[model samples]
Target: MDSWVDGQPADSLSLKDRGLAYGDGLFETIAVHDGQPVLLDRHLVRLADGCLRLAIAADIQLVRQELLSYAAAMGEGVLKLILTRGDGLRGYAPDPTAPGRRILQGNPAAAYPAVNAEQGIRLFPCSTRLSHQPLLAGLKHLNRLEQVLARAEWQDSEHAEGLMLDQAGRVIEGVFSNLFLLRDGVLLTPDLKRCGVAGVMRAEILFQAESLAIPTQIADISLEQLQWADEVFVCNSVYGVWPVRAYAALSWPVGPLTRKLQTIARALLDA
Candidate 1:
């Protein structure tokens, strides 16, 4: 499928686009199933919040319409929506009146071994650490050099995902997913107030847990805390959830809470 730029099919972006020049933008990678974007409202909410925080003058209603149209045409696969600050002048200052640039690219559904979800996966201890940026934290922004470097730390299939930490040695998330752990029947995830992308799936799981009367917490996680967790899992909007069996010297079993949430997540992505 061809990429769409501002509701029109285009193959190239302007050279002066702020997203290209200074990574001044936000993005959302959505999952399309049966011609509809899964978790569409949540994605939109996050995108809108990002635009508001970044002070980007984006017509979110127009972006929503474009996403629906694009997903309908795509039918199935992943849709990556890139919202740039439009073409800009030769410096860091952005034009206050410039409209946001919307780009939609479609790709085939992700293919991971079934064993990853069924049996469980190992976590590669990534040496690359996330930087602290409260203003930009939790927004799926265009700047992803930290994740790029973290992902590059491993190249083998032995580890299905890599665990990332902040410079302060606080466990944050995965290279492309959110991290969660179950301990004493309570679900706990890292607090993204300081860093990390607050993933759509992570938010959904938290909400689902709350509705089901399961205890959930968002707190600063340390390596010591993760070691004692009864169960560990990683998740994203596209891949749903995968139980984590091992990380470094620590290991955990697939607990009941993890499976319960996994079933909910699976239903959401497969629905």
Candidate 2:
């Protein structure tokens, strides 16, 4: 693993950093292959948009350059970029003039077991309900207590992911990825306006669907509707895409739509 910090080694972070105090920060986990960052521009766009939504001062170009440099050094791995509200006095209100901090870290890419991606993964429906906070709905910010709690609900190693529903029992997304279901030959993903991270891979798949003239819909999904879908898959930039073979007792095949999306995703990574 390799890392770079904006401050002194001992001054890793001050106790006054607002990010630690209030989760006032954002992060992006990117995939690096053959010394190149995958979907670099897309990740930057999302990161910049997140900073804007949080009112954080983040220069997209600077962040991109730093990420490229770090990724190049790491060669092939996972690149993590963390932007946080820099040091501040003890208070709930942020210091308007405080400088922000950026930390870039790189590590060997997480080795996803090939059989899981090839065959499929099992999912357990978590009892944790995602809270609807439109203000923080789509941004990948630091306040991830909901995901943490949801993930903790299941300790079974057989379960690769947990499906989380909204407070009203509407299917939202997975703990760390976007959810997409194939129903009656159409692709459907939950609307992110209510909750969940609007993942970069989700956006890429949506764009590819439009380019390929594949029918896609963004709507409010319910568990009952999901149970009847032809297939299910979860996606995130780091993990690419993986079909969901089983969610509780409900089962699905790795259908044509999933293969089509996977092909497109592979092409994007190759590009």
Candidate 3:
């Protein structure tokens, strides 16, 4: 097992840590291939942003170096890095002088069905609606009870992922991935300014789409809008990309745009 606590060899942490007490932390799930962490810069960028947003003091460059070393040791797997506002006394207030802690864990990458990318996967519309929290929106914070509750709605593997919506009935994202769709030749992804995680792969897709000259937009898509789309897909750093063939009663055929993004996604993930 590859694990580290605060750049040391320990595998355990203090019980009073803020991360454990109040979920005051952020994490990054990175895909490793051939001794490399994919999109490392992007991941670090998001991490740094989260740290700043939460007022968590950190040395991001040092953390990046540690991540690379830890990732290479894994050879091929998933690298999970957690940063928490070090342990503090019992209270809601944080101690500004407390240095943050970094916890790293490595595990074998999951082997998803090849057909998931080849043919496609189905979606389940989760009843758990995300609350409007602009302060925490787009940040991969430790608070993930909403996603946990939504994922608990289904037990079978019939649906590879569940789609979540905001309180306003606007489609937000998949349980663990960002959502996107192709409608009338335009690529549409849900706006995460109000909720949902702004994933690294999702950012790369937007950049790649611009270079590919594929029209793209970030909008509040309703369930009806998603149903009327020509094609649908979901993405995360680890999974790269997954085409959605069906969601509830609506079905879609994998279109040309999805295929193009899939190629780019795989390349980036394997890079």
Off by over 4 Å in 3: none
| True-vs-predicted CA distance for residue 50, candidate 3, Å | 0.6
> What TM-scores do the predictions have?
0.99, 0.94, 0.97
Q: Candidate 3, after superposition: displacement of residue 27 in Å? A: 0.4
Better of 1 and 3 by TM-score: 1
lDDT at residue 242 of model 2 (Cα atoms): 88
Q: How much lDDT does each candidate structure score?
A: 0.94, 0.85, 0.91
Q: Encode model 3's per-residue lDDT on 96-169: one tens digit a residue.
A: 66558999999999788888888889999899999999999999999999999999999987889999999999
Tens digit per residue, CA lDDT, model 1, 112-162? 999999988999999999999999999999999998998999999999999
Residue 103 C-alpha lDDT in model 3: 97
lDDT of 2 by residue, 29-96 (tens): 89888888998888889888888788777677777888887777778878888888877777777655
Candidates arranged by TM-score, highest first = 1, 3, 2
